[model samples]
Target: MIEHKDYCVPADTWAARVAGGDRRALARVISFLENDDPCGVAALKELYARTGRAHIVGITGPPGAGKSSLADKLIRELRGRGKTVGVVAVDPTSPFSGGAILGDRVRMQGWTGDSGVYIRSMGTRGSLGGLARAAYGTIQLLDAAGFDYVLVETVGVGQSEVDIVRVADTVVVVAVPGLGDDIQVSKAGITEIGDVFAVNKADLPGAERVATELEMMLDLGNHAAWRPPVVLTVAASGKGIPELVQAVGDHFAALVRADQLVKRRLAREKEALLLRLAERVRREILQSWSQEELARLWSDLAARRLDPYTLEERLYSVWKGAKEA
Candidate 1:
């Protein structure tokens, strides 16, 4: 078995190669990182200084919302504008194989030979949010690789998928016509996360109704920055793609004008820093405490010799000490 210590060194080496535009090296680094090897985290930290160059757009929606098709069309449109695009498709993990299905690749296969396009599929990997830690690290890798645009297509929405807003510069929430009831159920979270709303499959019967409902919701909400625009698109037929792209551009421009992009960047940095700190503290605490110590603490709690509040205080002190050391 490969030890974590052995893996960390090569992961940083691979990360350097990836930053130098070595595609095979990038792939290997990403794959290793996906497996949650400790080396992968080390590699990601090494590459962190090179990131934050790319414009990240997150595409999220309920299952069967044609999000993949919409993402494909968006990539094509972006490429047509002479931009290099990186796509990160987040898919559900296979319980049996411990790998992702990568179904989005089937829809985005046209870009296989395009040197300007780098496409990767990520597994949820038990991440509470639609994005895994590896996926976040991969996006940074692509951003550092100098991709002009990065598109993140998430593994549809659940309660946790709302976290996409924290990572994406522009978030496009796609929904189909027949899912109005479902939309209503999830509107609070989705509405707040989306910078732009897309009514995909516009050729369907209830597209207008969906659009109207979204518009009304936006109007009702007190969004001082910009009201999220609801655009209709027939993603399969490639209809309304141009308008959708335009809407995205307009939203990006609005963010820039309002100086929200700077705020967003700062917020993203803060989030990344906090996550890193939390992970480090958690790992150090786990490593420093022996099994006997853990058992003793638990036994004390069970016997009422230690109260929950006091135990929490003691744990905090231990964590602080570990962090300081």
Candidate 2:
């Protein structure tokens, strides 16, 4: 396991600044993490003890589900209750700039000047799971920063979006009306992941039908402990947002009452640990291999003299030997 002392001492100041509500420091740390800097990891380690205070909420669904609109409304609702919010909007990577497309940032301009609200737009960076690769760590940073709520708005990609469940304390799967065939196609993939379902654009023609289908889907599953509530929301009009917020709060309360909160967080930590270990091993292996060795391995593979499976075995053996040493 990596320790705080492994890194230089400067990160201690970054961690303190982040915890003390320095948004600039938090932004810099997020950038460092996005760029894969070791300082970000060190600061995170230093601030790890201060995390878990914020409620991490994931807003995700297929494209055209109005997720960003709903997130904006939710932020407003939470902030009205005097709760500070941190929003991490996962936008599609711009091919030109290699940065966020900035669509969510544009929509969420209302909160830009509010000191209690900090919104960050993160490019998906070709990450397939609707979230940026650095989103989980960024959520922890926001938690450590003392935000009452950390809302993660995903890129609204299809089914593979289940990654949100691993990080969020509450997952709100947003569905909009008028996408009949698309909804049918996504049912098997996304219907099972929601703790709360939001049928946004409630004023649309098929809003009730979408809500009904969601209820039917929920009924098909065994949710004896807590059933996910379907809330009809017109995010643009702020209709039913309070109810949506209540549903999210109810789900969280249910988790706490059932003693599942800590268990879920523990599972998240385990996953993060495993991922970190794998990443470190991969980096170390790559660094240990000389350019000539790498080139020769690639040449051999291309020439059909070495198979990928054998190459994988060889790398594993090297890693095992290094571990023993």
Candidate 3:
């Protein structure tokens, strides 16, 4: 029961309820984060100090690679070990509605009654990096809510999907067999971010070959400190899930032992800070501005009457005016 004024939870009360593991409170805070509520920001500022406890595992790979199924199995496996889990499932947004059509909740409905697991689905919402604008904040809220693990599942994979590596403690890239040239998971840029590579759908043909190829790629790469392991997983049947979980733990342990965990955490903080600052600056720059003005600017640029750089300078001048006003 969050004490609220106009649907906004009080900061102290919000923190108290979340700390107590109240599900409703947690959901309300999550909504606040999703909606970009000021109250949510305040609660986050208070709860921020309590974060960084949960291990964030990011599951990302190409479409149809069973990333969601793997995430579901991983949750079960984690719960078997007496761990509570939180999942941030990123789904592609509907272009017209700007809402997630098949968010993780629809697929993971079985866990709806489970007390040890919490699942949240976010629409990509036009965000380019396969994450919602509020994702970083959501993870911290989950951490402050006392989840043992926070798993982030990206919408899909590509070189740009590497943003997951910036936030997750361990990144597991899931791949399937039979895609020789169309292997999106193993692209040179995408391969470098994976802490562990999984050849999923092992029941299918060519799984072994995919695993072998991943291992060979790892061998060729200059991963001086640690070589990412390629594991076989049939996510649908739960095959190799235990081993995959172990691999995730092993990678985390390696990071810890090498004193690299703090370095990654530092990088995550830097990224979050920059992201927030940039968004804030942009929002303030456009506050109360009309769409017509922007459209006119675009039209002028399209007509080549105004160069982009000159328009940007003019926009900055408008921002300065707004700031002073």
Among the numbered candidates, top TM-score falls to 3
Query: TM-scores, in order shown?
Result: 0.84, 0.87, 0.88
**Model 3, residue 166: what's the lDDT?**
71
- Give me candidate 2's TM-score against the actual structure: 0.87
lDDT of 2 at 101: 57
Ranking by lDDT: 2, 3, 1
User: Model-by-model lDDT, in order?
Assistant: 0.77, 0.80, 0.79
In angstroms, the error of model 2 at 186 is 3.8
lDDT at 264, model 3: 92
- Report the alpha-carbon TM-score of model 3 versus the true structure: 0.88
Ranking by TM-score: 3, 2, 1
lDDT of 2 by residue, 1-325 (tens): 5434444367789999999999889988887777666778888889999998999999987776778888889889998999999988765543211234575343676776898999887765544332434677789999999999999876453434336777899999988888885554256556767899999999989889888988887788888778999999998899999999999999999999999999999998898777767767887887778999999999999999999999988978897788789
Tens digit per residue, CA lDDT, model 3, 92-156: 54322223465523356588789899988776445544245467778888999999999988755
Candidate topping lDDT:
2
